[model samples]
Target: MLNGCYLTPPEPKVITITKPVPILPPLYLLNDIALSHPPINTNRELLKFAVKAHNQKVLCNLDKAALRAWRAKYE
Candidate 1:
């Protein structure tokens, strides 16, 4: 009879440090954050929308924590 299990090297322990990320303020509250300046060659409107959405997602606590957890798990 042959052994099914194979000897493998032990996994390394990983240490992660987490920091609080600031949330994005409301549009009306922060006027400058509302506008985005993209390349002249590209579509300005689409870029503006995309930038706003990206900023909001980055500033969200749940979103940031979820992302951090996923990164830690994979890394």
Candidate 2:
């Protein structure tokens, strides 16, 4: 009778789920240097090689830094 209506259960609440966005690391481009041997007749050739090697080292360090930053933000 009318008492049955009062005994009915209430409707369930709707839950909303949101996904988290992914974090990405920066991209680094490496230089393509020729690995062939160069003539050592003058100091200029040695200096050129030294500069190229230094630049490559710097780029590698930058890559490591980017990875560290990404890991810090993620974890």
User: Which pairs, if any, clash in model 1?
Assistant: none
Give the number of the best model, judged by lDDT.
2
lDDT of 2 by residue, 1-75 (tens): 688668667899999999997765434332223345566777988898878877876777776776777766766
For candidate 1, the per-residue lDDT at 75 reads 44
Distance (Å) between predicted and true CA of 35, model 1? 19
lDDT of each: 0.59, 0.67
| Alpha-carbon shift of residue 63 in model 1 (angstroms) | 6.4
TM-score of each: 0.26, 0.44
